[model samples]
Target: MSLTWRISLKSDEAEGPEDYFSSSLGIIFPDDITNQHGDAEHSLIYTSPHLSKSLLIDLADPVKEDDRKLFSHYLWNASLLLAEFVESDSLGVPLDNPRAAQESLSFDVKGLDTLELGAGTALPSIMGGLLGARRVVVTDYPAEPVLKTLRTNVVRNLQPAISPAGSSTTPADSVLVEGHSWGELEDSFSTTHRHSFDRIIVADCLWMPWQHANLHRSIAFFLREAADARCWVVAGFHTGREKMRSFYDADALREVGLEIEHVWERDCNGVERPWDTEREDDVTERKRWLVVAALKWIQIP
Candidate 1:
C-alpha cells in the first residue's frame, strides 16, 4: 500500500486565511506520492450533493495518530457513506457535480433542527444545513483547535447554505459549532435549548464503547422527545481491533430511553456486508454499520 499520508496543520492562532495556509499549512502531498498507483494522500476532494464545487479535506498524518488534532483531519470511509445517505435523502436540486443523488428516507428537511455528535470535519452536519435544515449545530469534544477545524470545514464547504452569526470565532447561525463532551449531558447546553434537535447524526462515534452510555444519554438529551424525531448512526470497522467486536451498546441505548429501529451492515459501496468477512468477496473486508433509530421519550406511567 503506497498510501502514505502527510498532514500540514495551520496554527489555531493564525490571523487570517492567507496567514493560515502560509508555509505552516502548505500542501503535504508532493509529486512523489502522485506517481504511486494508490497514493494521493495529502487531502481528499469530495463532491457534495448540492454544491457545484468539490469539497477538499486535509488528511491526517498517520504518524501523528496519537495527537488529538489528528481526529478531525482525516476523511473516513464512513463519512462518505453518511454523505451519500444525505445526498440520497435530501431534497434534490440538480447540481453540476458528477455524483448522482439516491433517495433514502423521505422526509422534508426544510426547517428541521439537527445536531451531529462527534462531528469530525462535519460533512454530514454540513449536509443537513445544505439540505435546508433550519438549525444545524455540529458538536465535538470541547477542544478549541478541533472545534475551530470543524467550523472551518463548515464555512469552507457551506458558504451559500449558512450565514455565520456572532463573530468569525464563534459561529451561531444557520449552522453553529459547539464543544460538547458526552456524559455531561445537561452541562453541554442550556435548559432552554434542551430537546431542540429533531434529527441527530452520529457518524464514526462508536469507536469508544466505554463511552456508549454517555453517547446514548447525549443523544437522548439533545434529541426532541417526539415520534418523528430520528437519529442516523454510522460507524466503520476499518480500524481498532476491538471496536468491531460489537456494533453499539444496545443495552445502554435502551437504558437511555432510545430504541434501535433498523441496523444494516454494508460495505463502502452500499452492498450488504456479511457478518463473517471471510464469506464476503471484498478483499478489503472493511464494513460500515448504519443504524436508524428514534429517540423514545421516557413516559411517566
Candidate 2:
C-alpha cells in the first residue's frame, strides 16, 4: 500500500457497495460502508512490485474549512503523478536522477525515515513504507473528523495479510498518523520529530499561497539537514494558477534555504512524463497542469 490514487464519484444511483466497487478501475471498497449524500469518496491504493490491486479505503465526506479550500477534501491529480514518479524506473527527474539514488537504498529501510505532509489519503507515505522506509509519519491538518478517516485508511491499508495463527503482523511502529498545523512549530511538534526524516513527500498541499511562509517554517524544522536527504514534491493549480502562484515560484523555497535540483511539468492527462520523443507542441494543450520537483536543503558554507 505504497501508492494511493483517489477517484471521486458523484452518483445519483443508490447502488450497493458491490456495484460501486466493481465500477472502479481497480481496488474495491470495503463492504457495508454507505455512500454519503450524492458523493462517494473512492480511492485505489496501488500495490508495489507492479500496478496491481492492493487495498481500497473509502473516505468519509470531507469538511473543509473556509480558508483551507485548496486543502479541499477531494483528491487532486498531483497524487497520481507523484505515485507514478516514485515507482517509475526513471524516477521522473532526469537532471537529479532520483531513481538511481533510490536504487542504492536498501529495501530493508534500516535507518531510513519518511514523512508526508498534508497527506489527504496518505498514498505516498504508505508507498514509502513499501519502498523500505524504516518509519513513515503521515500527517494532515488538525481536523478531528477528517483525521479519523486518515487514520482508518492507514490502518486498513497497512494491515498485514491473513497469516497463520502463530505469525505476527506488519511492524506496527512503521507508520503513525498525526494532526499538525503548519507555521506553529514549537507548539505542535517536538525535537524528536524535527530533522529526523531521510525522505519527505509533500503532494498536492500547496493551494494557499498565504500559508506558503508558514509551510516553509514547518518544512525547515522537520526536514533533515543530511547531505543525502531529499524532499520529493508534486504540485499543481487545480483551482487555477492565480489562486496559488507562490508555490509554483522559487522565491518561497529559496527563502527557506531549500535548493531546487529538478523540476518537471505535465499536463493533467497520464502521458509518459519527460517525453521519450521529440518535444511536442500538443503538450501544452491543457491550460491547467501539474508540476513535480526534487528539492534539498542548501548547505551553508
Best of the candidates, TM-score: 2
Candidate 1 structure, TM-score to reference? 0.69
lDDT of 2 by residue, 1-301 (tens): 2122233343435268665654552444322112111122544334343423364544445555542443435455566556555444222222222333234432222247878788876766554454445677888887765577678777876554521122233356868888788777775454569888877788877767787787777777788888777777777544455545565456777888887666656554342254111233332232335556677787831
Query: Which candidate leads in lDDT?
Result: 2
Q: So what's the TM-score on candidate 2?
A: 0.69
Alpha-carbon shift of residue 66 in model 1 (angstroms)? 6.2
Q: Per-residue lDDT for 1-301 in model 1, tens only? A: 1111221223335456654444332164222222111111344455442454566554323333343533555555556556656654564432222222223344345568888888777877766666567787888877666677777778776655332231111124667788888868666373556788788888777667667777777888878878778777766664443653343445666677776665556543344533342233232344333322333445411
lDDT assessment of candidate 1: 0.56
Q: Give the lowest summed-lDDT range of ten residues in model 2.
A: 30-39
Q: Per-prediction TM-score, please?
A: 0.69, 0.69
C-alpha positional error of residue 226 in candidate 1 after TM-score superposition, expressed in Å:
0.3
Per-residue lDDT value at 131 in model 2: 45
> Model 1 Cα displacement at 56 (Å)?
3.3
